[model samples]
Target: MVNEAQEYLADPVLGERVAAELRALLRDPNRLPVLVLATLWPVHWQRLTARRDPDAHAQARALLEEGTRIRVPDSFTAADAHVLAAEGSDPRLRRARECAVNGEITQYLAGVPVLLQRYEDATADARALLDAAIDARRLGWGVDLPTEFLADAASGYLTRAEWDEYGEQWPAPALADTDEHRGGFPGPLTRVRPRRRLRQTAPVDRPACRLADAVEQHGRRSRADTFPAETFWTASLAHADAPTLITLAESARIRGLYRTQMQLLATGALSNADAAAELVNPLTIPALGALGEVSRWAASIVPLTDPGPLARFLRTLHSANQKEAIEVVLARGPGRRAELSNRFGVADLVRRLYDWNHYGRFPESVRSAASAELAALLTRHPDGPTDTGDPKSLARFVNMLEAPAAACATATALRPRSQPDPDPSDAEADEAPETAMVLASRLKRLAEAGNDRALIDLLAEKPARRVAVSDPSGVAHLLRELTRIADTYDVDEVRQLSKRESVTLIADRRPLERVDLTDPTGVALLLGWLNRYHGHWTSWPDRFLHRLEHRRDPLYLSLRDQPYRNAEHLVWQWERAMLGRFATRAAEVALTDARGVADLLNTLSPRTFNYCPQPVAQAALARLLERNPAHHVPLVGASIDGSAAEVLIRALRDAGDPEAASHLQQRAFAAGAYPYLRRSEYRDYGLLPDGTWSPVWTWADMVPSY
Candidate 1:
């Protein structure tokens, strides 16, 4: 049909007549199967419509409208491009496929080269408009540019002479060109419709556009060229939200545009504290190889504004081990180091620099300078290192400095010259392993230096003496020193001095009163030590058991959570210590109170009962039953189960409780022994396949009937 109507399509009147018949055929269901397709240029379509006749216009609209309009996409997707490339045997398809990039023809991929070509050839006004659009996109804010903003930005991009030539009528065409509608897709700039749904703050639909993603990528890739000097971006983006500024700031930093990055970050910092803190971002610091312009820009913002941002920025540089950057920044404000130290603290300053220097990053000169600075800081303090509240850290800082005067001053302040010599017999002092380690180290240094007074002062502290007990190496050193003193001095005078140093008394209390059960120190010295190191000190168990029986110590009842194993071990040790003496401390303590009986019985293992003397075992069992008669059956059953039935029966008989013993035996025999005798420990007592008691364990027959 297109072959027949070829000549008529060229003629306006004939084309209209032929288009009318095709439009009717399109509506007909029977003929619709016969597909009809056509293409027309925008210019050709415009020429075919009549300008003067209403009827001609109506006929023209009908012919085109009733036809199915199949529009060709302006660009090919990745898949379409690949298919085109694979089938590039056709020259036209091959030429079109050349335009594809990254397997697809993106708006930017197609448009940027054309825009660049246009930019090179275009007159001043067009270039101005394009420049404004590029800068806005390069700002790295989100890609939503209002047409009005583009116009304003473009006006700002124009010079005085250019603006004079085209003031209100800046003769640049609309950003979305009409040629785009005709399938000539020029890019790096494209138009978009406004999104105006509910909760959408986007403005009314008009000419809204954005630079293609390629534009920003291009800007970042090409950093050698000069960025625009116009302040229009600042004024236009002044009210931009924090997130947008942060994004732009990050982009600026990546592109080595430090001034731009700081400007964006500074603006964002006004409303966001985190953004304020972010001014310390390592990339944003001018001292770390940023351009001179950036250095100047930073100087303008920091030290001149709030010192908090500058201090944080300095700390970050120091933390990253960037020594040169710290020096450069500190050099900016001569008093910056001292000012920051005063504001935060010398302790914090020492802590920050200590971690860096501890790893040995700085040179000797740099370390010496840091030390001197710290020493000077110490001098300014009225009380030296003591004022810092962390003498160990301050002392360590000065020691690392290796400055003799500063180290001495810190030591002197730590231990005053006028400090009263501590009471040599004070045993009530608490012990801390950490503090002891530090003091012990200091004492060794002082003793090596032959600073007798300083060493004495250090030893006077209670924690200092703890080193003698807790650390073997420390006690060895103390013993050697004492041996040297004993050999060098008169023996009697040395003995008197040693007697004064001995911690035999507590305050004014004598040695006997010191370990009294009611005294907290004495209680801890016995029980706490026994719990942790029970077997190491055998004497304390006997002393502790003696106190348990004789002493009126109410605090013993509060001893909860003490390790039962430790109690068992303590009981065993107590028995060993008591064998030489006349009294059975365990039995005596069990007879004291109901709790004491339970405590004593609970700690009495079968091993202890088997090994313990008969009188002691009888005393414990009788006391347990005397306190609570109901304990008799379980006690007898426990003895049988533990394979110590002989011990329980003998103890019962010897304790003058034969009737109680006989009743217990009858209960065990009535129960038939199988249940209680199943324990593996009872295998040695006696065994039979029928689970009956052996003769050795069948004490019911041996029990003399009362």
Candidate 2:
């Protein structure tokens, strides 16, 4: 049988030699010791097949069935049977059953409970595997499968009691439940309900009300609340049959609430005179009227574009019984009828408007309107600049005109009435320069009085001295004037003034050259003025440079030369020092004279070289080499013993002198030379007693060749 089993195991056809030997071993009681080894044979073969083959299910199934069906002794207990049954419970162990039934386990398990238990276990295992797969997927792996297995497991696990408890606590479908509706315990399937559709509704529309209707309604509500009050009287007069809204507005001015009435009228909602009067009456209260109600009334009349009504209304206010009403009409008329330059007595009214306090901060619309009228008057009548006779008004007029018109008006204003055409035969003709000076003096006085127009006026005369002379030392005063005009007047005015003044001052160059550079205060002031008013210098470079060059007093020289002085001065000195050094060097070489070389050398003190040591040495050496190359040899040797040797050697090397290289190496090896030079390339040249060059080994030469 052993031979037969060996043959059978060797046979490629049946391939049951190992199985036959195992059976023979089981049949012999003497070979029962082999059963221990035989018992592990199927396990060993299964493990081997699992390791070697991609699919081991068939092999594992064959091994399991062969081991199970092979008869065992009756000495085995129920525990052993149970252990075997447990082994069969494994899906891997059931591979034989699955293969025998072609993956259908239905015919293998006759007991329903056993089948059900196995199915439950398999379902649970499937769920566990799915859970692991989901976990892997969440960690960015690529596993995907239907959720049916999870649904089956969840349904199978939900007992009646469990379902009741789950329903009581959660009462909602678990996210894991994905099955179709089933008749088991209430799962997600039975609880889900269908959705219902919703109905639609329509939108409503309405008509819009006119602004006039809205204002009338507001006025009616106000009147009802204040019945038996003066507002009722005002409202009644507002609705009276006046020819225009301006008439009603004039009538409302006599009543108490003209301010409120005017506000309503200005809303552009009043369709008739009566409504305007009602609006204007509330604004006439003394407290309300004085609160600048007329300004608002005037603005309200603007959109009406019928200046005739506004002009007539203002005339009525001017003729009103109250003095305050007259004052308001006169003072606020120009701003109100700003577009009507030809209105009766409007210029006088505009002049009166200037008298009102705080004109600068007037409503922008009012100021804009007033500016237009004033600009027109100034344009048409050059002589009638302003009716007010106030210098500020004239200034305001000049400020409003175009440049040419302003210039013409200023010239006309500044010329003395008699001086329009001066008599050449007059005895005072000789005093013309004095007269011009006096005119300049008067113009400056006007400027001081805050009359930029007068200043600009006198400037147009081209006074003998366009620049007003206050104090020669008062540069601060001059700066203040420039800054004042720069800040307050237009740029062209400032520029014209500056140009005329610059020309006037050009004759007396003393002011330009008289800077006290040594006086710290004067220096600081001058520098600040220079920097602040640098724009003024765009036309005066030669004048500025002249002052800088000619002012060389001890104070000026010291300040100019100080290293720790102002940054501008310091920068200027650095440039000057560099130029002076270069110039001295150039003279020393170009003159081909020993005196020039001596002069250049005399300037080379330790202090001079220390401050600008490199450039100073370079310049000196360059001069020496160009003048006389031999003259530099002793100097280079002397420098080699001093602190400037390296600088001197670099300068010579840059001049392409090979002797400089030989001298540098010799000096590097000299006694008490720079210790660091022992490691430098310059150490390779040694000085010979006969004054000849010789090569010497350096530490670099000792390094091994790569």
Candidate 3:
């Protein structure tokens, strides 16, 4: 009953009311500061002004003054008369007076009430999300939170690896009940946080010294005066899983607990070995000053002595951990020159540095050293660029664009192949593969500065299309000023510099502005850019429509040979719109291509068959009927079991149009006028006028490879 009453009194709002009543007694000059302190939290009194407060020493002395050092209660029970005198028989009556006195000046009224109680009231999922957001903000991890936080809150739970990796939402699965929906209990291997491990309550302020301790502990009005997070991190580290330890290291990084983070970094047994990399992001992780002596040697900075405790600590690590630990040393330019080579081959270390380029947290000197070594490796001609990675990695070497023209060319040459968090408490790890974020930022910055030369300079640097798509948040800001961004380069320059990825991104995903298309350059660029995927005949149509749908001009109709034939997959309903537009094109122009003929067959108004006004479709079907199976590829994008032209031919023949049939037979043996659906070298051949054999191709075979 007493515990329940104490919890009720702990209510922050009620605590404020009780504080006012205790402070009101201070107006009686007879009251000793010591007695007054016993009845109220020192926080309220510290903020209060006494008459002698103007002088610094006087203020300090007055704040801690005692009346002749009289003995005070070892602990003040609220039942004591000193407190009960100010307390009221009715809680409501006391609240009404305190509320009337404080009025607008109260802390509760200063801002939206964000009491910790509200955080507790949130659902597990919501609380996790809130905690993750708060953790990310405090840790300085970028806003792009991990996927765990993004999953359906009701179903997914953050894993130890994920939590340690990204610091998503907390509850750590082990801490929460086994929801039937989320499988059985997490099991014995799961490390559950102790319920009361991190926080300790001060024994409810007892003697005069206890109140003084509260004042000392509370420090200034600012929360920064307390190193409470230190305790939070320390408790977390003692019990955290390998993944969670990384998060603790990150917290230590935030708290300037460099020594603590360094100790953690020396441990290689972490569930995720990458924790060491995260701990010392060069600038954030300064050179471990004076635990050991560091001196400069050429471009290499070396520790003259061992890195103090870290040297002994390295012996305890696994090989991988030892490698990472030494790399951290080498990266900080502290260890011997060949240390990286000894631990990881020189070539391998270069690749690790390349990976770190994506991190963007490495010190400039470290990054420069890595880049120089990589360049030197390339210069030696011992191994080709392909020795490191594929063209895709080369393409997306986040800093590849930041590289000078020569270095970017090297990365471009190497491009082709592209390439788990354990901490639940850490909730959010750094943004995974922030390459998009990094590239987008560069584009945004370059675009803002109107550096057309630099923007165009990126024409040489390329990544895969999906990889090149900028982050939505970054792109949103980019698009808001796209017109200005577009103006940075000439319209012709855009076409000249545009990669297949960029053309598709603007044409489909982030639509180009009307002004960009006014010259018809961007439209043509979109069309040409689409030529890269002709190999996937089934998908090419979808790609074309997807990429061209945003084009203001209906130039698709004007093209003599449209590559895409599938309409069922029309994402933007462009098939219907394009068919409607096709009604206006000349019959000869529309009939030659299989897509044109197939469009006509499916789009015919079901209500009427006689004198169908789709003459282009009608003529095209007649022409196709003339050709035998040998004359066309067996199947095109629009073709059913029979070829597109063959299917249409049957429909026309069934319609019993003699004029069309006569026209079909008259030219039946003649060479096909349109592209074949399924042409092959074996059947798709013709006799030359000179009587020698030559390959014959439908019009599609003739469209130049862009």
Candidate 4:
């Protein structure tokens, strides 16, 4: 085919026909060749003019000369029967029209973009005419015009509303150049109306709290139905029935009105279906459902072919809603495959939860929720998970769960609830092992020489084990006893993720640290053991001494006077003192922020280094706070050394707090309020070998400068 084309074109007989056609076109004297020349990029013309071959360059240069020499048609013609009247309007739009009338394609292309500078600023008629030419060009009818004319015209086309109004301006300008068409321009090119959503105004602009107040006040005198429709429709809502509903949706997103919007949707007060139907076109779906209106929002999701928007929208919904939406996809999505490896983001969620792969990409809260759900999916059905490919192999646990609920109650029995504190006299002895550790020791002891009372207690805790399993003492208790010594793992519970499928590694509301068994803490955690000195303390010491211990530089000079060597005892003392001194205030403060208790705990943290340092103290304080004595002393922010304390105290003072004065007084007392509020003070005293005083400074003056 290639050889044939070359041979046929090369024939002199075919060549002459082409040359005749060229001559006819060149002699025609229409501005089309000039128009086509105008559209050619200057760089392209330069390439041709600068060609190496003389004949080719001459031909290109001639075309260039022809374009330049071609007189731009200054006169005008009537593509439209109407008068070419953009008379007193924008000079640019009028100029565009003059070129259009005269069929001056090159001239029109050159001037259109420059002349019609501002579409919005342009007069209505000017805008309409410009839009008409652009549409007609796009529709492949503006033939007499240059192809580039549409490009310039579109730079300043009619406003959206003008597009529908001007429909088809005139018979398409039939151009002389048959090959020229703006085929690259987008089509189905008729313009639609400006979206009512953009133009409409919401009823109110206040935040939720203020709106709630207003709603409360409004409800006091008149019902929501009786509340003025006029109030909601201050704008000329006439012929704006759909827009009015849209306005309401916008208002509802503003804050307090989310429920109001849902109410409207539920009751059909806004005629949601009608409003949606009215704007069913891709151009008019208003933004919605950001305030967790998901299930209802499902019906109105934009039918955009792109799933990205929908996926992102689903993420912003409430967790329950998010799970529901995922379930929706699982239950009704393509083929309704209820298989475990569905595209429900379950695997991703599971991966995120366990820190399996995503690292910390999802927040801990999200991970916690994902974990709960994955656990539920594993445990929900009696048959257990349907797929082996599940990220969590739930099927293996079917045998474990088949046992009665009593079998699962071992964890609760092992860690008995609400035991009394040990006697203070027992501090030095500290010989009593942890109950779990004791259990471990007892099991070993029993295998050697059984004790009946201990066995009875064990049987009481594990009644299902009275009959015994493989182990004579009961396999369940033996297995449960491993948590005391070997660091075996277990699910916290048969967790119900929701009321769908649903972070505590050990137990609900219990702290968890994954056991390595190699490290001391891990070893102690697993064996329910502690080396008595793990945490023992005596009193709250000065901050300076506390800071030394905090830095891991424990000086005997600091610890020598302390009666207790155990850091744990000191933490125990600090808590008793803290609660005793500030119970009332702490309770009040916890209402506002539980971290207030943590803040107080952190204040003593430097001194409590070995027992309850920051991370450890925070956990302990959290557990203590969770127990909620209903009375905790509000922290004396002024007494704590930080700007946060000052800020808190200042806030209370500004709020006219009575205790603010007392707290400030405490701050003063802490800052050495008395001339000599004496405590035993020790200064470093250098001594010689014979115990005689040494010179303060053989090096420098007493109050020495560096």
Per-candidate RMSD, Å: 43.0, 51.5, 35.6, 36.8
In terms of TM-score, which candidate is stronger, 2 or 3? 3
Could you tell me which 10 consecutive residues in candidate 2 have the lowest summed lDDT? 205-214
Kindly list the per-residue Cα lDDT of model 4 for residues 489-561, writing each as its tens digit.
1222211111000011111111112222122222222222211222212222343235334444323233445
lDDT of 2 by residue, 5-61 (tens): 222232211343344334444444564444322332221233323432112133233
Error of 2 at 115 (Å): 99
Looking at model 3, report the run of 10 residues with the lowest lDDT sum: 206-215
Q: Tens digits of per-residue lDDT for model 3 on 297-352?
A: 11122221222222222222222233334344445543233332221133334445
After superposing candidate 4, which stretches have Cα over 4 Å from the reference?
1-113, 117-123, 129-294, 299-310, 318-329, 334-706
Residue-level lDDT of model 1, residues 1-706, one tens digit each, is 3522223453324455566555555545565455565665332344344353113334454455445545556567778877867766976456546864544354434455555555455456655655666665544444566566666767766778878887767533635341143236445456676566675575455566666544444543232122443344554455455556765565444333444455666666555423443554444453334333333333333441233334444465454455665555444432323443233234445554444335557776555555554454555644456443355856665454434323222321111123344542322224322432344345345545666554344444433233424332233233334334433434444433322332211111122222222222222222222222323323234444444445433323333224435654654544333331211332333232222233334334334444445565456555445643223323312212433333344445454567754554433332222233223442233322122333333222211220
By lDDT, is 2 or 4 better?
A: 2
What lDDT score belongs to each candidate, Candidate 1 first?
0.43, 0.35, 0.34, 0.31
| Alpha carbon deviation, residue 71, candidate 3 (Å) | 56
TM-score per model over all chains: 0.27, 0.15, 0.18, 0.17
Candidate 2: stretches off by over 4 Å: 1-300, 303-343, 356-373, 380-706
Better candidate number, 1 or 2, judged by TM-score = 1
